[model samples]
Target: MLLTAPDETQVIAREPWIPRRAAVCLLICFCLTWFYTLGARTLVPSDEGRYAEIAREMAATGDFLTPHLNGIKYFGKPPLQAWATALVFSVFGLGEWQARLWTGLCGLAGIAMVYLAGSRLYGKGTGVTAALVLGSSFFWAGAAHVASYDMGLSAMLTCALCAMLIAQRPAASPRARRNWMLGYWAAMALAVLTKGLAGVVLPGMVLVLYTLVSRDWRTWRRLHIAPGLALFLAIAAPWFVLVSLANPEFPAFFFIREHVGRFTSDVHSREAPWHYFLPLLIVGITPWFGVLAQSLRHGVRVRAAGFDPGRFLVVWAVAIFVFFSLSNAKLPAYILPMFPALALLVARYLDSASPRATIVAAAPVALLGAAALVVLWFAPAWIDNAPASTPVRRGQVYWITGAAVLLALGGAAAAWLARRARTWALTVLAAAGFLAGQALMLGHESLGRDKAGVAYLAAIRSEITPQTPIYAVGQYEYALPFYLGRTLTMVHRAEDAMLLDLERRPHLWIARLDTFVATWEAQRARGIKAIAFVRPDIHADLQRRGVPMRVIGQDARRVIVTNDVTAQRP
Candidate 1:
């Protein structure tokens, strides 16, 4: 088999063996990198545990319309993510992988969508490269396995964008066009369910901006607005109507408060500088930073002829990037939707890039990875931001150090490949770095072991009777309720975890500390078995107030106590 010149196609059509081998390798790498590590770590709190528990509670209670957290109504976001997780739980039974199955699957689907989109817009080689970039990108892969709504949102948004692009193809048949348009509508509706109004708003904004720039006013006529809208409303509206009807306050809370207020004000206190996502995007793209930047730069150039998918991709990436940048609240994952478009653009750039240009681009990633390796191996002390009193284990430290070494070698190999003008080296290096980075992240789970409370919950599992009363007093470890297999009585505080749900269903929460103390004392006097999870500070205060409790488990952040009993080692 003779090597063909690297051209627009990049693939050697005369010798099909090359592409078949490449495809086989890509599939194997995808499986190992994406799916194998889904259950490597305990679910981390705030988001992972919260979403997983919501799904668990939804499955346990059989209330799909109203999302619940710790037995209270939770409306922070829409039900799509929870609904999907619940469905997974129903099938697989509750566990870490089961909770994350939907998200991981969606992430894989998003990669496939980008591959198809890139193949249609560019060539087979470009399509394969696009899939590699997306599946290997650190941020995308990180969000892919986490039990969060953002992955779902990103997948649906990609579907809508890719479907719209297919629908608008000049050579497509009428029936094909209609089906693609329907896909676009269905994806948009699912996106709305996954997140909030941003599902519809972000895609609509992107399309409108693309039309304005491309001067494709006729494209609007191709949407078939009547039936398209009907399809959208049919898929997206029934849930809103049912949820709102079931909980009247949901309308104001979900739309006005969650959507309008969250965007316009600092309601969630997730304030960040205007350029918050800039660094995140940089770090998220990881070793491919140079390629991604060049792609965006090349993508924005006005095409003289043809369909100009690059221009549309540019609009998609830039519009979404700017939209969240201008919003009052921002998070790292907020810009995930832009990545698929960016990957396609980068694939196009790589497909046509010169050897010198490729080397120049790969240099920075090598340097960056080298710097990170130095920080991890030589300056391990710099990474220890945890409390000085916290015990550091030599074994775990060495494990992290090993992961860093793997990353450094990956960087070095990538640089070597770049110098040799190996186009596929970027994918290989990225896969190595991402796989190592994931291991590093998974290893960090040791740091949060106490906070995650998986071990603590195991110790207390037998102590908890069917009717044992549990209280989260003055603190909440998001993983506790899920691990304990029961909802906690939120004692004396109903803020972040409870939110507006507290107002609607305050019975699940004791709003006054004094009332909670009195009830606890009475329960103790009556010889009722009860357990409470409280912060260390709160535990000391309770101890000072002569709260009769025996410590059953202790950690850096929390102390689990039982009301007046001979606490066995747990």
Candidate 2:
């Protein structure tokens, strides 16, 4: 498409592709990246189970008044995300694949929205490039599959910022303000529902900072404060008010303990110093990390020559970083919302960029992609053992570190090759996407293979017959019950409920590395027919104790033990 500025002025920016190609690339990117995740077993540990459990409770109890964690009242977050997960579970049933549906869907929506927002703000190519980079981000992919609150938060925040950007345009009409303002409030309110006040707090702060830095305090006038406030309260307030009324402690738990308390103190997982967000931005940006730096520096150089690009890009980017840094609570994922700004900035830099800069950016991304292939090829070996002391597992981490190092080197090479050209921005984003995709395709096995709760539960369903008892020792993998479609009791001690549960029922499956030996005597004494486990340490020790726990069936990793004696202990 061709375009001219207002009054037939110079065409400041152009997108090379027609609308059709842009949409297709984005759609293809979206489908390929997360299409795998939707089908994959829940890669996350507790988050999937915790959220899925809450949804199950919501559907089962029919009382959405309070959030429940492990069957207890859990007020850690607002109900928006839980409600969405519940809707999916309601339709699809409570499995990780079904429960995580919203995350993947929202992730794709966010990718599309990025292109829309970027294309409008800059040009088509820049918009596509921004989406490409952000889509492949480390957090983006994981968040899509993890069934967590972060991805929704990212979507909400992006929509809010993009809406606000449209609202701030000089030539913005009342219609634009109303449309975008409504979107802003709606997204903010949903964000509030998803994760809590930070949805409103962070973006609000960023906008205020942007206004201050942009020397456009007057911009707030079009914010349409009256309607904005009404919309936010209308969307967000009802849930808060209702939930608070239903549970009086909701106010303290949701607002104070979670938001205020979490920020001032290390409430959940007290992380490191202000430097916490540094690696996060790096990892969260991934493959594109090098490209973004170039974008920032190049964008800055262009603006220093009396252009507004630096002010807009730098202030927006730094403001987000500073906002999170000042907050005491920090997680790598918390910085996700800041990416759209980086994307937009990168797009702008590329739009005005020389061809050389574009090529340099692509080289690093290509290198990062190739590096991910290396990780995938070796990820199986890496997942074989604990990272405690094994040389192979240690080398696996080295692989990740090495991939990262090469990615950086490639960026330097791109900068050297392209010099100060705009094409650098174009090259890097595609490369980042390619590498990120490689990891997604080949590295899925490496994530939770050794302790794969889904596979374990599946085996229990298929192999064990007639109310077989399943006990997870050493640690409770919460995902077990969700995948198994059962309520699992925890074995506080080896001799605790697991022993008793097995006694009450026949053919029990116990999973523990430390106390497998003791189970053999108990198995024989009780006339237990079989012992099923992931290791043979227990079998070895039991044999040494003169108790024969023969392994009937064994896989590459685990062994199954069965005593020849049948019936209960007499």
Candidate 3:
């Protein structure tokens, strides 16, 4: 075996065995990789949480077509994700977990889709390697855990491109050609549903670029226009037509504002430089990142071999990469669709690629270990001051620091394994990284970021009778209402719908931002119980106004502040 743990990537031009052992290993790794995202359960309404809320709202309101955000008709994103979440909610009943179930499933589907594309088009060995690289990829992994639209978008994009690449060929039969074109149409439709026009455009452009660079327009013969269009419309048209009809302005905003304006501006607030994805790609797809680099370097050397599998994949990867790289606004996820292309190229290169290059590349694995130890060593100083008030135990940071050390060891071990032609060791390194990172998230960081707010909301539920009107001062955590089984009104800087609700009811709870309240010092004085989800000083500052709110529960970024009603002479 010419495989090593650090570079277990297989040959891209042939088929490999579907080894049972490898299958089991991949299952376990992916299973553990996304092991616990609190089952997409209640915590806080992140961007993802908010989207889920919109879907639930739609289902409840019987407004199946139009997408709503914060109970308002929002036409920013397409209705695919919301619709998907709504379907799950309708079937399983709405909850945090149910709302995110479909997206989470999509994440898993993407991993499997990429693996199939790599294995079938390239080789089985390459397929497994690609799957490992993708699963361990930071952005991909993070997307899987969160309820954001990116995961679903990535899944669709990968499928669309992979479906097209695998099916596109010069001497394809009629059936194969029909299938490919149909795939193009179906994938394009799903992509549109997932994230609107760019889904189709990005993949379509990449395919066009690959074919043009390869000088192989003959593959266009496979496009069965009638059937393809039919399939596309069947999957995607109903929602678009209904939603557009429901809200007449959807087309203009969705296409023009979301696709065109987003590309040209930083309205989504994910703006980055022209080269943002360049470094982001490298760092986000770590360990195997060296694999993508080596693959590209090898690709440049063999560029003259026109129409070769390697060239086609490289062109596909580089074209997509450069396309997003040149864009004014970029996000780490903008490069996701490029991963499969890179993986395919790497798989091909690994078939006859140099051993020394891979081994030498594995050297960086050591740096990860050093980084972990450094962070762990000064964790007390570096770890966010967890408002938990429990003295920072060394045990708490142990998991992340330990995992860091383990990945570093993997780098060294992978180097040795590569020397011995043990490519599968690469799988081990990825598994270690995945386990470490995921464990740390669930075990520690998630406590503060994912659950603290939910916990704060949960604690005061008893105090919040049915009559209690809840107000979210800054933003609503979609998961909060779902978890608490109640909805909360949102209040901005000014007195709005939320304040009116408070005036109308007795048991009123407000998710007040400390600074916003401090600015409106009058409100801070009236607030009997302050649930501070911020710095200690903010709460301490409030004491100066004669409002004594005690912290009942604490996490890294959130604190539940409640005042003693008995002490107050009302």
- RMSD, every candidate, angstroms: 4.0, 7.6, 6.6
Best by lDDT: 1
Q: Rank the candidates by TM-score, best first.
A: 1, 3, 2
lDDT of 1 by residue, 1-570 (tens): 322222222243311113578758877876876677787777888788899999999999999989988878888888998988898889889888888888999999899999888776566767777887888787888898788899999999999999887777665688988988999999999999999888999999998998888787878888878899999999999999998888888888878888899899998898998989988998788657877767887776625243456778999999999999999999889999999998888877776666555565567666775676676564456445555633444435665666556656766676677645455566666676577667666766676565587778766786689799999888766887887778889886765636777776678788888888898899988989788988788889898999888887897778988886655554
For candidate 2, report its TM-score.
Answer: 0.74
Output the lDDT of residue 515, model 3. Answer: 39
lDDT tens digits, residue span 155-245, model 3: 8877776666556533345677567667778877988888888777886786687677768676555566678888988998888888777
Compared with the true structure, the alpha-carbon lDDT of candidate 1 equals: 0.79
lDDT minimum window of 10 residues, candidate 2: 2-11
Stretches > 4 Å off in candidate 1? 1-19, 302-306, 380-403, 418-423, 566-570
lDDT of 2 at 112: 75
Writing each residue's lDDT as its tens digit, candidate 2 over 1-570 gives 322233211225543443576657756665775666575554455566667777777777777767764345667777777787777777877665677788888777777777776666555676677776667666666666677788888888878877776565544577986888888888889888888888888777776766676566666676778888899899988877887787675686567777788888776665568888897787676656655777777644553211133455566678778877877778767777777778776666656656654665566565665666566667656566555535435544544554454454555555554554334434544444544444443344444544444445543554455444444433445455565555433332332212423444433433443345465456556755443442345345545777554444454444544454342234
Runs of candidate 2 with Cα error greater than 4 angstroms are 1-15, 18-26, 29-33, 297-313, 366-435, 438-442, 462-476, 489-570
Looking at candidate 3, the ten consecutive residues that score lowest on lDDT are 1-10
Better of 1 and 2 by lDDT: 1
| C-alpha positional error of residue 38 in candidate 1 after TM-score superposition, expressed in Å | 0.8
